[model samples]
Every structure is written in C-alpha cells, then in structure tokens.
Target: MIRFHLKCDQDHAFESWFQSGEAYDKLAASGMVSCAMCGSTKISKSMMAPAVSTSTSVTPPKPSAAMLAELRKRVESASEYVGSKFVREARDMHDGLVPERPIYGEAKPHEAKKLLEDGIPVLPLPFMPSKKTN
Candidate 1:
C-alpha cells in the first residue's frame, strides 16, 4: 500500500493508503476520494515528505469490530433512512424547507461534494443504512 497526504478544496489535510499510485489516480479521477474533515470530493495530493517514526512515537488504536457494530446500531436506530433522496432531503432540512431530523441515505460523490460546497452539514456513516419499506 502507498500512503499519500491529500488536501481537499477546503484545505483540510489527511493521509490515506491506496493500493498503488495508479489506484489513487483512478479513485481521484472517479471522485471517490473525499476529505476526512468535510467529506468534500475535490481532493488533491499535498506536498509531503517521508516520515520516519522513532521508538517514542505513539500510534492510535483502531476501533474493534464490536465497537463499530454498536455505533452502527445506535445510528440506524436514531436516524430515518431516505435512500437515494439523501441529497434533496438533507438540503431541504438544512434550508429549513422541511423540519430538521436525523436522516441517513445514499448519495453520489458529486452530490455529496455539492452539498458540502453549499455549506450543508452532512456525514458519511460507517455502514450502509438499511432500506426501509412498508
């Protein structure tokens, strides 16, 4: 895996691991890469130098599967699933055209980027929302 330091149009910097340089290029071209802070899809590689970690360096622990599962459960229980209409629903809520409530749904990368650019707050949940049907 190769790690690249990337920044979004909003100038938030974060590092992500890709399978290879080509993998990063393809994903970026497809607008799949997003900012870790704002979820913006307009990302570019930032200038970075190789890091050399010493013995004194500390690493953060990864969350366990159990923890992630529990989080998914709580979020799913609290939010309404809006499916493919996520972008419109979220924008309506943000604009006060609809009553604001917790919601989870699907969005294309470009849709998400537009939402962020419009200053609407949204987040990508760790798990796909279960589709609700009558």
Candidate 2:
C-alpha cells in the first residue's frame, strides 16, 4: 500500500492509497484520481517527505481512544444504521430508488469497490465498533 497526498485544482487537499506508483500514474492519466472534497479530477500530487527511517527511535503520534470513541459516536448518531443492507440501501439511494439520507452500514471490500466504480458516493468509516444487537 502506498499513500499519496494530493491536491485538486480548487486546492482541496486529501490523501489516498494506491497499489503502486504505476497504479497512481495510470489512474491520474485516466482521470480516475479525484478530490475527496469537491470531486474534481484535476488532481496533482502534493509535496510530502518519504517515510524512510532516519532514526531508530522516531515514533508517530497516536490518536487518543476518547477521540476515536467520540468520532464513532458522532457518526452513529448522525447516520442511519442499515447493517448488512448497506450496499443495497446505498445503491437504491444513488439510483433514486430510495430517498437519499445519511447512512452507515457493513459492506464487503469488493462491494465498496463496486460502489465507487458505479459512481455512487460511499466512504468507509474507521474505528467503528461492532453493531449492538438488542
């Protein structure tokens, strides 16, 4: 996995992972690379230092557990939990078969990829706890 920081024509900055430098190049050339904020295809790689090790003791900052928990809470509270129906619900909404609203749910990796390929906007939320069943 290789991550690259990118900027769109509107100056929206975001990061995305590609399979390789060749993959990124191919995508960019084909206009597949786009901005996360504005969905602009006019993207360019931004300056970022290589993640090579300069010292053995260097460490990255870790996010607090409380912060992750808070983020998870906010996401759950703001979105409807569709559970396993996530892919279907998202597709329905995108195709105008259902009303569009904030939603969150489980999808297989391939499902998410298919959604993107179909131009249905979907984002994966990080640090999501298991869905509570009652």
Candidate 3:
C-alpha cells in the first residue's frame, strides 16, 4: 500500500492510501477519490519529496524547537492524561459516569482492541511522552 498526500480545490489537505500509483490514478479518474473534509472531487496529488536518492550530501530537514514545543502544547491541551488508567478511564467515560472529554493514555494492544470492539472511539497517537519512573 502507498500513501499519497492529496489536496482538494477547497485547500483541504489529507492523506489516502492506494494500492499503487496506477490504482490511485484509476480511482481519481473514476471520481471515487474525494476529499474527506470538504467532500470535493477536484483533488490532486501534492508534490512529495523523493523517497530515495544516491546523493549523500542532502540532509533531512529537522523540526524546529518552537514547532516541537507547539506540538507538545497542542497535545497537552487537547487531551487529558490518564497515565496507566487509560482503559479504566475510557470505560468510565463510555459508561457515562464522567462527562465526555478528550483523553490520552497508555493501554495494551489487547485493551485497545477491546475498547474498539466495544464501539468506543480510540486512536493511537504517534508520539507519547515517556512516563517518568522515580
């Protein structure tokens, strides 16, 4: 599977997975590929950086410290930290004991699967701060 960064005429950006480049073209031509945010069909692939190169002089760009701090702040503000009690907290919220709120926590894969099976919305965050052990 290949992931493509796509943009719609409405300036909405999103990623889509396609089986192959040919498959992406086929779907786009058939009007099957639509923007998730705006539901616009006037979508096109955005320019992507080359995946591989023989040149060793090119250096990968790094995220600025300010950008990293901003990302951390966004995550911190957007979700409540439940630590190791993620599963229990999630279950509590699902049962309506606590008011619904965005939360983030660590859970085993099995726990996450069970939560999903129970129809609770959950997504794995790409980055999570390590729990300090003192």
Best by the TM-score measure: 2
TM-score of each: 0.53, 0.54, 0.49
Model 2 is weakest, by summed lDDT over 10 consecutive residues, at 125-134
* Per-residue lDDT of model 3, residues 1-134, tens digit only: 57788999999877766656765786577565666555677999998875665757887456567655555565565567888888998899879888767667788999987887776656565567444221
State the local distance difference test value for candidate 1.
0.75
The Cα error of candidate 1 at residue 118, in Å, is: 0.6
Question: Which 10 consecutive positions of candidate 3 have the poorest summed lDDT?
Answer: 125-134
| Residue pairs with clashing backbones, model 1 | none
Candidate no. 1 TM-score? 0.53
Clash pairs of candidate 3? none
Ranking by TM-score: 2, 1, 3
Q: Which stretches of candidate 1 lie over 4 Å from their true place?
A: 1-61, 132-134
Error of 2 at 89 (Å): 0.3
RMSD to the true structure for each prediction, in A, is 11.8, 7.7, 9.8
User: Residue 67 CA error for candidate 2 (Å)?
Assistant: 1.7
